[model samples]
Target: MQAEYGGDLTQITDLDLLAFDFNPALRMRKFIGESKSGSGKSAPKALDRMIWQRGLRAFVGAEAAELTINSKVTEQNRKFGRELGVSVQTLSDLSRREEALLMAEVEESGSHGAAAFALVEWVRKYTKSEPELEVIFRFLRSKVWFLDSFTAVKQTISVIETLSKQWVVGHEDDHKKAVRWLLAEAVSVFSLMLVDICSEARLRPRFEFDAFVAARLADGVVPSSEMKQLSKSIDKFIAGLLVAAKATPAVRTGAMGAFDPVPPAYADSFAELAWRLSRWVRASDLPRQIDFLAHERIGLNRPVPTMAAQRIQLSNLNFQHSVSLVCAFLRGHAALSPDASETLLNLAVQPEETMSDAVPSDADVASPPPLALKRPGSGADEFRGQDYLDFNDPD
Candidate 1:
């Protein structure tokens, strides 16, 4: 864009709150916002802001705009805004939304926000005094959103295959460095997990959580469709063994099936929610859900989450969907059983460990843990768990 224009877009695109989500058509659905505080004469007026914002919506190709001001929004002004395709947000509206999101565990400090700024300062300070720190800091910046989310993430994901090794090699000498370094690592991991999640949706035409999830385990080693077929083959082979063991007088069918892996913790309690999620992904609600996730992130933390994605490649629908999926999952987290929560914590709760190790080599990723394939002894009613796939499948 810079080369095409012969100038940096940094100045022209300064319209506040230009957030976006991915779609197949334009490949982006953008929301622009303009905000001002205080109702004094010197302060920007609501009508004026909306007028300019409407123009900006066209200039940047945004589909929506929100104009926020301290003054009361009159009916006439609201009508004009509606005609102009910009929505109005008063201070009270923002407050109510924030109140809704307020949680005991959420800190006053921005969610992973201040840490990023501090790391930027720390890096600048170190590099100015120590020339040797240049390469490391550059590498670090390449991996982090410190330089900004869009460009940096593009660079990071392209080289994501080597991310883990690079992380293992980085410095973590002092307390501050270690903490900041680890935070960066976690953010990168967040990006990886996000990418893998989307990758599943991209690789296959149809949507099924288990198939893509299996590919995720493969660590991007095998095509998702192939992995799904491979898993089916494995299950069939195991089922044949189950029948064979029953034919032998000495052998017990249950003993032959003893090797069946236990379902992941909370697989039962999570079955309903997980099934809902899969259905939503495959349903019309997905676009709306993604839109809500994009806008809600801005409402949740002004700059924390969006900074990691803003102006990044629009083709990164996987990242966007993964983010929305994770947000949806986390939103329902409280409803999970306590043991399930503990299992999640013990699992890769940290951003750094979620898809922590980068894409695997030619070596295959293990298939998703299969549910117990019932042999002859148990009735279909006795069988239960996460395998409740589609409406067509026997419940």
Candidate 2:
């Protein structure tokens, strides 16, 4: 069998090696060997002849037989032998100490030996440190052994951070209270995101108010009726911001920063809401408001418009509304009065009846089961006969 692209060949004969010369500009190299069929008696000798003719720098024979000096056939083997004057050895033989020594000497004298040795030394020096070795090991392990999904990694990191915080704080009442409030606020915002707003313009403001409600809930504050009213006003203000963003001339129809001219009344309303919420947020009892605001901005949910045009129109508006709500609260905090802030905090912190515990009215109660029938009808008669049957009956 003939092998291509660096393969071992053995045991064939009666062949002629033809070297073809091509144009130097073409840069082509070619070797052709041809063998003819012969008698079975001559076949063995033919095999020996072929083996002797095609000797290679690295000769791998089927039976691991050593080639005699006279048996060297190909110019490649002759060149290899002349360069090192080394005896050919199988890889298994070279793995042994004695043969390995001879092989090592041969490798040292080989054409690429110096370059290979330099590479080995370079790698040893550069990768000897613990950190370097660890990095290499990790890279190798990642590519060749371990496979991890990014989603799983992210989830694992989140879990680790959460668990670490919980462990550090343990079962402290204050920590538990904080966790409960956070959960409640998350649920509230999630609920608001699911709410269906009738007007497209109303969506951004509604989302903004939801964010504030979420922040208050996180602070362990129950929103009052006034707070709810203020949230609605804030939503309207955000809607106005959207309208202003839409009016900007430089803003692309579907690109960012299109909104620029918020209505004065809407801006005023937003400022008022921000001023009120900021005071509550800055109070000692609600110090986590900044964190809540950051989280809300990062996590704000946008509603999908029913059409492409609607989506393009709403995108910049939504963004403007979100920015206005956050910026107003951040900038207005210093202007709030101490007494007003204290009152807002007290209102937020005050215990209020939860929806979970709200009592049902009398109308909500089910009426007593309809009075039982005094007489049996056709439907009841079928079962009535069976009910009257007693154990005393005989076949």
- State which candidate has the highest lDDT: 1
Residue-wise C-alpha lDDT for candidate 1, range 220-252, written one tens digit per residue? 235445555666667667667867766553443
Q: In candidate 1, how many Å is residue 138 off?
A: 12
lDDT of 2 by residue, 1-395 (tens): 33333437764542233222222121112233333334344443323433543453123221112323222235565455344332333323335854645544333221124643453344335444535343432332122111122122222223222322332222445333332222222322221211111111122354565444333322212334445555556656665675777755333333332232222223334334433322221111121232232222111111111231121222232222332333333234223222222221221110122112358577535634222112222242111222121222353
Model 2 accuracy (lDDT, Cα): 0.30
Q: Positional deviation of 150 in candidate 2, in angstroms? A: 42
Computed on alpha carbons, the lDDT of every model, listed in order, comes to 0.43, 0.30
TM-score: which candidate is best? Answer: 1
Question: Candidate 1: RMSD over Cα atoms?
Answer: 18.7
Where in model 2 is the C-alpha error above 4 Å? 1-271, 274-314, 330-395
Question: How many steric overlaps are in each model, in order?
Answer: 3, 7
